[model samples]
Structures are given as C-alpha cells and as structure tokens.
Target: MAVHRTVEPSTSELGTFTRQNANTIHGHALACLVAADRYAHIEHEIKPSLHAGDTVICDRYLASTLVLQRLDGVPLEFLLDLNADILMPDLAVILTASPGLIAHRIAERGIRHRFHLDPTMPGREVDLYAETALTLTAKNVKVLVLDSSNATPSELAAEIADTLPDPR
Candidate 1:
C-alpha cells in the first residue's frame, strides 16, 4: 500500500481557518518518497518476479494522487505530468460510499485532519474518485468501483480477488 502525502501543511498554520479553506502547500515530499519506493520495489522485487504473465496488486497507486491532489486544488494534468514517466496500473479499484455514511463513520472514529473535518470532503472525494476511475478506464485500465462503506477489509479483499483472473 502506498499513499503520497500532498501538500500537507499544519492545520494550525492555517490560522484557525474554516472547512472552506483549500489553501495548501502542495509539496512533493511524500509523493517523491512513494515514487522512489515504488521504483525501488519494482526494480528490486516486482519486476524480477514477473515471468511475463504475473500480476502485481498495489493498495494505492498514481490514481490516488490524481483524485486526492485534485481535491487539494492541484490540477489533474499537473499530477499526471508529475508522474508521467511512471508505469500505469493494469487495474484500478475505486471504493466509494455516501457522504453521510462516510461522515457518520468518521465521526464514530473521530476526525483525522482538515480533510476529515471539511464538510465538502466526502462529496469532493467521491467526485474525484469517480472522475479518476473514468479517466483511467478511458485509458484502457480495468476499473472496479466498490461501495466499501459496508464491507470489512477481509470482505473487500475477497470481492476484489474475484475481479482478477488467478495466475495460478
């Protein structure tokens, strides 16, 4: 699993702002690390293991950046150009749910950041994810959109597994 941190500014630095604040520092810090780690892992473990027909499953990939970064106000084209040289995914699984469900769930678990507290977050995230899935699908990558607000991780894994052909 990999998630690139995009423009993570301290919430305190926002000068006690409201959820409407979309201002961010769009740094490549975490993105750079993920990109590096991805390259290293692919070069070291994944590529070597491929016998021309094997499939690799990643919990998060470039699509994550496009969706999340766009929410942070970074342009989709910019994100893609940032990762232009990186390889594309063969399949993408996008999980979505009602904002109300997500909001209630997060309330139960408490909040994480400005993102979690943002009233616009749930809807924006859902839209970005759908947009990302559509974009990837148009590029010929298979995409499975899962409504995961109800599934446990184990159940989700099982469902995803059914979508892929077993190399075995």
Candidate 2:
C-alpha cells in the first residue's frame, strides 16, 4: 500500500499552483487547477501503482474539493461538473473532530493557508465534511466517518485499517 496526496512533489507545476496564495487567484481558477492536478496525479501515480497491485491511499480527494472549493464561494454544481471525469475512490474516509478541538489544534500548529485565518472556518469545515460524507455515499462510494476528537493517531489508523477489504 502507498499513501498519495493530491498536490505532490511541491516543485511540480500543478503542486506550485496549489501552494499559491488564495487571494492571488480566483476561486474558480483554483478549482480548475486542483481538478487538473487530480487528473495528473491519477495518471502519473495512482493508476500505475494500482496496476502493479498496490493499494493507493490518497490523503485528500473529491471530498476536499467539495468542501474547500465551496468555502471559496464556488457552487456545488460547478464543482461537481468540473470534477465529473475524475477517478473516484473505493473508500472515502472522512476523519473529523469537534469544531472546538479542530480550532485548538490549528492554533497549536499555526495557520498553513488562507482559510485558517478565519476562526469560523473550523466549524464550517466540520459541517461541510458531514455533508460531503452523505454526498459521497450517494455517489456509491464507501464512506467512513471517524471522530478523531478522542482517539489517538494509532487508534484511528487501526480503525480505518479494519474497515479495508482483505487484499488477499
């Protein structure tokens, strides 16, 4: 099994686009860049690994777009349409925690992106992720929602691993 992320190898053109300040780019434009990166990621990394009989675990996928892009003022339908041709995950795991806990963790870790500047974003993200879970489920993607508020990292990994089908 291998773990992959949407924007990888930060030096790549698409990865650079993802690192740009949100204020410098239009929301719709960023969404397009992200979708393009996803396609590139699938073709360059995910599909090849899967063909070799490897399980690829993506850190973020369509669900992230459904939530973050929507936060940037893009409509759901536009996002859905933009991402309509992307590869869908077999299992979409959504790890969540209480808004307060999430906020506290972010504070401790310091802000990484423009979204973290808004204090209300934490609560909004929690709500959006819950909604995203249902949306993914409706698309026939197996959705697993885990609360990370109280569990340790190891515990959460074990729980997620338990839900995976045996590769045998």
Candidate 3:
C-alpha cells in the first residue's frame, strides 16, 4: 500500500501556498489553483499504484477541496467541476471527532496545513465534511463516516479494513 499526500514534499510550492494562506481566505484562488496543479502531479503515482495492484490510500483527496474551497466561499459546483476527472475512492472514509478533540490532536501532533491552524476551523471542517459525505452519498459514492472521538488508530484501521472487499 502506498500513501500519497496532496503536497508531496510538504515544502513544495503548493505547500508554501497552503501555509501562506492558513488563517484566512485571502489567498483562496491561488490555493485552489495549486490544488488543481497538484492533482495533475499526483495522478502519476496513483495510476501506477493501481496498475501494480496496490491499495493506494490518499491522505486527502478531492473531498478535501470540496470542503475547504466551500469554506473559502467558492461554490460546490465550481469545486466539483474542477475535480470532475479525478479518480474516486472505492470507500471514502470521513473521519470525524469533536472539534475540541481535533484541536487537541493538532496541538499534540502539530498542524499540517493552514486549514488546521485556525482556532475556529475544526468545527467548520467537521460540519463541511459531514455535509460533503452526504452529498457524495447522494451521488452514489461509497462513503463511510467514522467518528474517531474514542477509537484508537489501530481500531480505526481495523474497522476500515473490514470494509474492504474480501479477496477470497
């Protein structure tokens, strides 16, 4: 299994774009553009993994853009249009937890991108993710909403693994 992130090195130009725009939507357009660019860059890896029969688990995929861009005031239609051709996951897992717990986890593990830095972002992210799950479900994508408030990482992985198709 290969794990891919939207920003590969985390210090690439796209990573810089995310960091510089962490607090507000002042740089929303540029960030969205960067996401589009990264999508193209990341596709090479995803395609090869699938061809080689690996289960590729993307840390953040198109669903993230739907939530984050909407938070920046971009309409859902626009975001959807931007990512219409990207490969969809077999099971889109929407992991959720209380905003307070999310904030605490960020504090403990360190913030990844600008979206997690805002003090008020957790609640909004939680709500938007939930909404996005519903929207994707409506569109017939397989979605699994799992609350991580009390589950350990191993337990969460086990639960997710159980959802995978049995090879036998």
Candidate 4:
C-alpha cells in the first residue's frame, strides 16, 4: 500500500494570491484549478506504483477540494463538475471532532496556515465536512467517518485497519 498526501502545492505563490484575495470568487476558483493540476501531476507520477498493485491512501484529495471550495461559495454542482474525471477513493475516512475540541487541538499544536486563521473556522469546516460526507455517500462513494473527540489515535487507526477489505 502507498500513502500519498495531497498537500497544497505552490503555496508561496498561490497562497500569497489567496491571502490577499480571500473570499473572492474568481480567486478561489483559480486556487481550485491550481490544486487540480497538482493532483493530476501526482497521479501521473505514481502510475507505475499503482499498476504494481499498491493501494494508494491519499491524506486529502477531491473531498477536501469540495469542502474548501464550497466554503468559498462555489456551488456544489460546479465543484462536482470540476472533479468529474479525478480518480475516486475506494474508502474515504473523514475524521471529525467537535469545534471546541478542534480549536483546543489547534491551540496546542498551533495553526498551520490561513485556512484555520479564523477562530470559528473549525466549526464551519466540521459542518461542511459532514455535508460533504452525505453528498459523497449519495453519489455512491464508500465513506467512513470517525469522531475524534473520544478516540485515541491508535484506536482510530485500529478501527480503520479493521474496516479494510480482507486481503485474499
């Protein structure tokens, strides 16, 4: 199995643009396009590994794009159209926690970037993720949502591992 992470590419360049133009419709759309291009590049690079039977586990993929873009006011239909051809994950694990808990964790670990710059972002993100999960499920994608409030990391990992399909 391969663990691939979808990090925000061209952050310095695109991030500067995003920071300056936060909440602008066109700006947000441009950022989404940049992210799509990055995902495409990563998919091309890992084609061989996938062909050789590795189960790629991407940390964040299309789901994130959906949620973030929606939060930026992009219509869900538009987001779905944008990602029509992107590969879908076999299992999408959405880790959720109460906004208070998430805020606490961020306070302890520190904010990574401007995405969490707003003190209320955790709550908004949590709500959007829940909606995203429902939408993805409606579209027939298998999803597993785990509440992170009470579970330890090890416990969550064990549950996810157990949920994987049995190897033949």
Best by lDDT: 2
- What's the TM-score of each model vs. the native? 0.70, 0.91, 0.77, 0.79
Clashing pairs in 1: none
Report the lDDT tens digits of candidate 2 across residue range 79-142: 9999888789888889999999999999999997888889999999999999999999999999
Candidate 4 per-residue lDDT, tens place, 5-31, comes to 434332445544544554444535654
Q: Positional deviation of 68 in candidate 2, in angstroms?
A: 0.6
Model 2 TM-score relative to the real fold:
0.91
lDDT of each: 0.65, 0.83, 0.73, 0.70
User: Which candidate comes out best when scored by TM-score?
Assistant: 2
Query: Which 10 residues in a row give candidate 2 its minimum summed lDDT?
Result: 2-11
Ranking by lDDT: 2, 3, 4, 1
Candidates by TM-score, descending order: 2, 4, 3, 1
What is candidate 3's lDDT per residue for 1-168, written digit by digit as tens? 544334322345655555565565444574466465557555666677677767667666667777877877778887777777767777788899999999999999997766676799999999999999988888777888899999999999999889975432
In model 3, residue pairs whose N, Cα or C atoms come closer than 3 Å (at least 3 residues apart or on different chains), thus clashing, are none
**For all the candidates, what are their Cα RMSDs to the real structure?**
7.8, 2.1, 3.5, 3.8
